[model samples]
Target: MHEIISGLLEMTGFSIVGWETILMWMIAFILLYLGTFKEYEPLLLVPIGFGVLLANLPGAGLGIVANELVMNPDGTYMTLIDIANNYGILNFLYYALIKTGFLPPIIFMGVGALTDFGPMLRNLRLAFFGGAAQIGIFSVLLGAVLVGFTLPEAASLGIIGGADGPTAIYTTIKLAPHLLGPIAIAAYSYMALVPVIIPFVAKLLVTKDEFKIHMRKMDREYPPKHEIKHMRVVKIAFPIVLGLVVAVLVPSSAPLLGMLLFGNLIKEIGPNTARLADAASGPIMNTATIFLGLTVGATMTGEVFLNLQTIGIIVGGFLAFCLSVAGGILGVKLFNKFTKKKINPLVGATGLSAVPMASRVANELALKYDKSNHILQYCMSSNVSGVIGSAVAAGVLISFLG
Candidate 1:
C-alpha cells in the first residue's frame, strides 16, 4: 500500500513540489488568461502559454536538457548526438530551428510577402523616422553594458526595442542564445501592448495642434490614375535594387534581406506567382509561428526563467520600447521644424515596427484629437520603414558586437 501511494504521487507530479514550479505555473496561467480573454497577441501567447504549462508539469520532461556524459565539465559544450539522444523534443526544435538561426529569417520572408511598401515609397522622408527610432536600440545597448551585461548580451537585450519579434529572435539567437526566451517574450509582449503604449507616449509628447494636423492625401500628390503604371514598376524593382544595395553595404544581413526581397519579388510578380506568395505568407508562416512560440516558451523552464536576470530583462525591454516611441516623436518634431510640409508628430509613434497596430493606434489618437485628421497612410510610411530599419540595426549589431 505504501509503495503504491509513493508511485502514484510520483506519477502525478505531486512528489516534486517546489516554489519555482508553482510560480512558473502561475505565470503560465496569467499568460493563458491574457492571450485568451485579453486578446493580447493570441496567435503567439496562446501557444507559448501552453508550452509553459507543459514545461513546468515536472514529470513531462518536455523542457531542454543535455546528457551528463556528453556535457563538458567546464559547462562549455554538448555534442549534436548528445542533444538528439538526451534532450526533449522542444530542445530538438530549439536547436534545429532557432540555434541554427534559420527560423527568424524565414519568418521575415513571410512578412515581406504580406507587406506593401507603397506608402513608404511615396512618402520617402517619413522613412527617416524609422532610422531615428533605432536610437533606442543603441541607447539600451549602452544601458545593458552599464548594468553589467556582456557586449553580446547587451546587443541581444537592446534588440527588444525594435518591436520586431523575428528580428529580436534572430539577433538574440546569434548573440545570446541563453537569453532568447526572455527577450522574445519581452519583444512580443510590448508589440501586443502597442495600442496602450503608443497612445500614452504620443499624448504626453505632442500638442493638440500636432495631433490635429491633417496630412495631404496621396491622391492629391500623385493623382492615382496617372501613377498606377509607374508605381507598379517601382514596386517590382524596389526590393531587388534595395536588396543588392543593402547586401553590398552589410554582408551580415544578406541572408535575411535576400529572403525578404525574394518573397516580395514573388508577391509583386502578379497572378502567375500568387500561389507561391499565398503559401509563403499563409501556411508556412502559421506553421513556423507555432513552432517558434512553443520552442521559445519551452526554454523558460523554472530553473532558467525565475531569476533576477529575467526581471532586469523585462524592465530593460520596457524602457527600450518607451525610448523608441519618444525618439520617433522627437524625430518628427525635428523634421517639422526643418520642413514646411509639417508632418503630424503623432505619426512618429508608429515608427516602432509593430506594423499596422502601431499605425492604427496613432490614427486613432489623431481621430480623437480631430476627426478631420487622416494620417494612417503617413503613419504606415513610417511603420514599414521601421521594419527595414530594425533589420538593418540587427545586422549592424551582429556585425559589430557578435
Candidate 2:
C-alpha cells in the first residue's frame, strides 16, 4: 500500500511545493468566513473570496498560460503559440478590464443612478463638511508613504479613505495594479462595514451631550411653489462645466471626474434613453463589478498579500478613517460657533467616502436621542458632500502622483 501511494504521488508529480498558492487559499477562506458569518460586505467579499479560490488552484488552468518559448510535442511553434493564446483567459480578463480601466466608471454610473443629489442641494453648506471630512485621504496618503510604501503603492493605499469603492479601484489600478486585490477587498469590506466602523469613530469625536444636540430644521429656501425642475439647460450645462472646470484645470482628474459627470448627464438628460440608463445601472454595471472584484482578488494570489506593506496599508487606512471623522466633527463645531446653529457631529462620520450608509447611521443615532429628530436631511447633506469631496481629493492626488 505504501509503495502504491508513493508511485501514485510520483505519477502526479506532487513533489513541487507552492507556499504562495497555499497562503492564497487561506486568504480565500478568511474572506468567505468574514462575508458569511460576520456579514462584512458579502456582495463584494464573497465574490472576491471566490476569485481568490479560483486563482490559487495549481494546475487547474486557473491563472496560467503556456509559455511561448517552449516547443510542442508535434515540433511546431505555431501549435504551441495557439495553445498558449487559448489558455490566457484570466490574464485576458485582467488586462482588458483592469489594465484598460473601463470597469470603475461603469460601476459609478450605477451609483449615480441609485443616488439622489437632492439632499446635497438642500444644504449646500453641508458640502463643506463633506470636503473637510476627506482630510483623511491626504493624511492617509502621507501616512502610507511614511510606512515605506513606494509612492504609487502608497497612492493606491491612501485612496481608501474616500469610502468610495469605484474611486478606490480606479486609483489603485492606475497607481499600483498589483496591489488591486488587497486594496479592493479592504475598500469594499470597509464600505460594507461602515455601519460598524463609522459610529465608533464618531462617538469618540463628540461628548454624549454633543451627540445628543439637536440640529436645526432644514430650511428649504427654494420657494415652495417653485418646484426644482430638472432643467435641460442645467442638465446639459453641468457636465460640460464639470468637465471643463475640474478636468481642464486638473487634467489628471479627467478619468474619474469626466466619467462621473458623463454618468450624471446620462441620468439627467438621458430620460429619453431610459434603456441606456438601465443598462448602465444594471447588467453593464454588475458585470463590470463582478469582473473588477474577481480580477482584483486574483491579483492577491498569496505572495503579494503576505507582505509587510499590506499590513501597513490596512493599519494606516483605519487611522486615516478615524482622523477623518475627527476633522468632520471639528469642522462642524467650528461652523456652529459662527452660525450659532447646532450641527450633529454624527453627520461628520458620513463625511468619509462611505456615502449613504454613514448618513443613514447618523440619522438613526439622532433618532436614538430624540424620536422626533429628522436629521436624515442633515446627514445626507454631509453624505453627498463626502462623495464630491472624495472625487476632488482624488483629483488632487492624481495631480501630485501623476
Candidate 3:
C-alpha cells in the first residue's frame, strides 16, 4: 500500500507544501470569483483564470518548470541546455502576437469591415472630438512619470487613454514588455465597462441643456443598401488606395490599415464566400478573444501581479480613460461655439474606448432626455472617428517611442 501511494504521489508531481504555490492558487481563485460573481470582464477573466490554473499546475512546463532536454533523431531524449529551444508555441505566440505586433491589426480589419463610415461622413467635424479624446493618452503618460515610472513604462501605461486595446498592447510590448499583461487587462476591462464609466463623466461635463440639445438632420444620405451592389470593383480600388497611402505614410500602422481595408474589401465584394470575413467578426474573433484574454490573464501569476507596479498601471489606465472622457466632451462643447446645428455633448462621451458601446450609450442618454430623439447616426460617426484617432495616436507613439 505504501509503495502504491508513493507511485501515485510521484505522478501527482508534488508532496510538499510551499508558500509560492499557495499564493498562486489563491490568486487564481480570486480571478475566478471576480469573473463568475462580479461579472467583471468575464469573457477574458474566465479564460485567463483557467490559463493561470494550467500555468501553476505542478510539473507543467510553464514559467516554474525549466529543464533543458534534447530529443535525438530516434526520439531518445538527451539532458542538455546547449541545444536550441525548439517547438515552443508560447514563444511563437509571444513573438508573432506580442513582439511583432500582428494580432491587433487583424482584429482591426474585422472591426473595419463591420464598421459603417456613413455616420462619420455626415459628421466630419466629429473627427476633432476623437482627436481631443486622445489627449488623455499624453496626460496619463505625464501622470505615470509623476508616479515614478520610467519614461518607457510611463509611455506604455499612458496608451490606455487612447481607448484602443491593440494600441495599448502594442505600445506596452514595445516600451515595457513586462507590463504588457497588466496594461492590456486594464485597457480591455475598462473598455467593457465604458457604459458604466462614461455616463457619470458625461453628466458631469455637460448639463441637461447640452445633453438634451437637438440637432438638424444630416444633409448627407447613405446610398440605398443595394444601390452599390455593383460597386465590387470600387471595393478593390478602395483597399488598394487606402492601404498604399497608410502603409507608405506609417509603416507601423500597416497592420491595422491592412486589416481594415481587407475587411472593407470583403464587405464590398461578395467573392469572400469562404466566410472568412464573417468568421473574422464571428467565432474566429471570439476564439482569438478568449485566447487573448486568458493568455493575458495567465501572465498575471502571483510574482508579477502581486507587485505594487500592477496597481500603478491599473490606476494610471483609469485616469487616462477619465481624462479622455473629459477631453472629448470639452472638444464637442468647443465645437458647438461655431456650428449652427449643435450636437449633444453626450455623444462626445462615445469617443471613449468602447466603440459601439460608447455610441449606444450616447444614443440611450439622448433618448432619456427626449423620447423621439434619434442620435445614434451622429454618435456612430464620432465612434468610428475615435477608432481612427486612436490608431493615429498609436502609430505616432510607435514611431516615436519604438
TM-score of each: 0.94, 0.86, 0.82
Candidate 3 local accuracy as lDDT? 0.71
lDDT digits (tens) for residues 18-50 of candidate 2: 777777888899999998898887767887898
Q: Compare the candidates by lDDT and give the number of the best one.
A: 1
Off by over 4 Å in 3: 1-27, 33-41, 64-92, 216-240, 271-274
Instruction: Tell me the lDDT of candidate 2.
Output: 0.73
* Tens digits of lDDT, candidate 3, 289-393: 666655565566556666899889888888889898888899889888987667678667777646788888878888888876778887777777777777777
Candidate 1 per-residue lDDT, tens place, 185-241, comes to 899899999998888888789987787777864346434333445887899899999
In candidate 1, the residue pairs with backbone N, CA or C atoms under 3 Å apart (3 or more residues apart, or in different chains) clash, namely none
Q: Which of the numbered candidates is closest to the native, going by highest TM-score? A: 1
Ranking by TM-score: 1, 2, 3
Worst 10 residues of 1 by lDDT: 218-227
Error of 3 at 146 (Å): 2.0
Kindly report which residue stretches of model 1 are placed more than 4 angstroms away from their true locations once superposed: 66-82, 217-229
User: What TM-score does structure 1 among the candidates reach?
Assistant: 0.94
lDDT of 1: 0.85
